[model samples]
Target chain A: MDWNCTLTEERLSDYLEGSLLPGEAAAFSAHASGCVQCTQLVAQVKMLVSRMQQAPPVEEPRHLAGRILDATLGPREREHSGSGMFAWLPSIWQPRFAMGLVTVAASILIIFHASATAGGKTALNPVNMFRAANRQVHLAYAHGAKFVNGLRVVYEIQSRLTSQPETMSEPISEPARAPNAEPRPGQPAQPPASEQRQKSQSIPHSGRRHTHGASELAALSIISREDLTNGAIRSIL
Target chain B: MRRHTRRVYNLCYRFTGNAASSEDLSQEVFLRIYRTLPSYRPEQGAFPTWLTSVTRNLLVDHYRRTRRDRLTDSIEDAMPQLEEKHSPARTPDRLAQASELSAQLQRGLARLSPELREAVILRDLQGLDYAEVQKVLQVPEGTVKSRINRGRIELARVLEEMGLRPA
Candidate 1:
């Protein structure tokens, strides 16, 4: 029988353990009997394995099981920090650096929060929003006062026009011009400016003509774009 | 759990050679086992084999994490050669010799690569069968056997260096 060095080394453990097939075992035994090198190799490995097998195991702690159970059930109490974030590190790890880092991080957050609350008002007031509202209020009030005065004059003009509608044909237009002494020889129908003003200011004689003028003026006075510009939203509120 | 606690502890001790690390690793192993209880399928493999795999993985993680702190040593110069001293075959003498041998073996075990060391520890030290080792290692039977043989050879070389040559 021929001994294959590689094959013998590979199957030596199986052979020693009696796990090899009957025929293979017999053949290996025959080869090992003739091959001193393989035989010595087997003996040396066997002795090494025996010494290793006899190697004494270190004793386990009595409290390990209790500690494990307590850890799993309750909050994990530190036991040498076996699986902790710093567990991988040696005892030489500097706690001071870690503490400093945490302190810096916490301080940064606190300072950021303080600054945000304190500075947010001024920081976000990109356009002086409070001043904008104040300016808008002042303008609206000024425009509203002017608008009210203009409305009173409009009402007076409209009331006069409605009362004197029969005289409104070319008569209302004559008061805006200056009084003149010149009179046309063929066109004596137009009144002088002062007389035109006096006549227009008085009420007209026709009832149907006055009613028409009053209805038209009332319709025109209901709303105007100037009302919106003068903060008419205040009325809605 | 009690039956295997010693084994897990000793394996950790052998790997780390530290009492504190063994205790911590033992607690962590049981904790991990409890955490992973739902994932264990009995039909796939035996419980011990599964437990050993978990333990080996944790030790590997420990080794890598602490590699920066671990001291490197020359395997040849690690243990000095000495003249073999013959003592009377007394119980005390045998116990002392066993204790001394135990220390030398541990140092030797530490010097081996993690894979070979694990294979040797699982097969020879822990007394697990090849099949169980294969399951724990997740390697082919051939690989397990080769690793064991290689590990034994290296362990024998280390022991020889420590002046414990077999007649």
Candidate 2:
């Protein structure tokens, strides 16, 4: 085979696949052997093609054909036509089934997303979740958060009233008190020290010592606006 | 028909990296085929090419419809992840390396626009000849070839970036 000195780059794939003429094959071989760049390119092309070929063939999952038949045919039509006792059911009712399927799938997705984004730990541990969340609200409030943002602010204030202490600290060795447990007579409505201490210890409150500042009051007012009005109405009644 | 299933599956798998999505898409393609079987004209083209066209059209439609929903999933799963335990291989180290390369390639394929990726997959992964790709894509042979060439070069550049491809 008298060989050419060069092979066209565009036809390299065809030449490698043996799609070229015998004479063209002889020419490609000579060029590939003599030219380092062409040789490298051929090798790379072969590797690429081989990798594609090597991709393991994955079959359609078994029962898929049956499922497809069920989808496209009526139940009686499929049943009478196919002998298999387990022939596919009619898909005429599929729109309703599909709706239910979508609902179930959406619920599962919602649940999965919630658990995944929530760090997949101890979702059943309500005490811990509540405790952790209580601390977050406290921290956010400590930073003088401007808004709770949405219709959920009422719930936020309700929850904050339950878990967080009105005052951040407590004198040690006393039992914990609830955050909004009523204040003693003639005193400002700060929670008692022991109650504060117990609640603080129960939830790991890692923020700086609470600053009893004006922004904190403003945040509290914004959060408790509805609750405060109801409380005043109750007092008058 | 059974033999063609794997090819259809691989095409779907390439478009969608996950098994769950692949299964759904493949089933969707078959259902689509069943519905549109009446419109198929034998004289117009061969069956596999027709099937490929059907598959590609469904895949493109799926991409467009679900692109928005996919963004939310990306954001939700945005945290850096470590090795997944999906491989059945006994050699953990080799399996992990293989998976990383495969993942790199999948990512590269995904980075191409749908048109380029479809052309590349049909030509390279599916091993369809240029003319057959022209049939499936309903484009000129030259256009198909150009898209394929551009797609392969870009994919190779990506693979090289990951150090999966040699100089």
TM-score of each: 0.49, 0.46
Tens-place lDDT digits, model 1, residues A132-221: 556668998988887787666656555564555445433533333323325567767567778755754564544345456555644554
TM-scores of chain A, one for each prediction: 0.28, 0.26
Q: Extract clashing residue pairs from model 2.
A: A176-A195, A177-A195
Name the top DockQ candidate. 1
Name the TM-score of candidate 1: 0.49
Q: Give the alpha carbon lDDT tens digit for every residue of A13-99 in model 2.
A: 567567789887877888788888667666765665567556554445565555555665734344334446634445534699879
Q: Score the docking of each candidate (DockQ).
A: 0.32, 0.16
Task: Tell me, by TM-score, which candidate is best.
Answer: 1
C-alpha positional error of residue A194 in candidate 1 after TM-score superposition, expressed in Å = 99
In order, candidate lDDTs are 0.69, 0.64
Estimate, for each residue in B135-155, the C-alpha lDDT of model 2 and write its tens digit: 888999778866876666556
Clashing pairs in 1: A163-A204, A164-A204
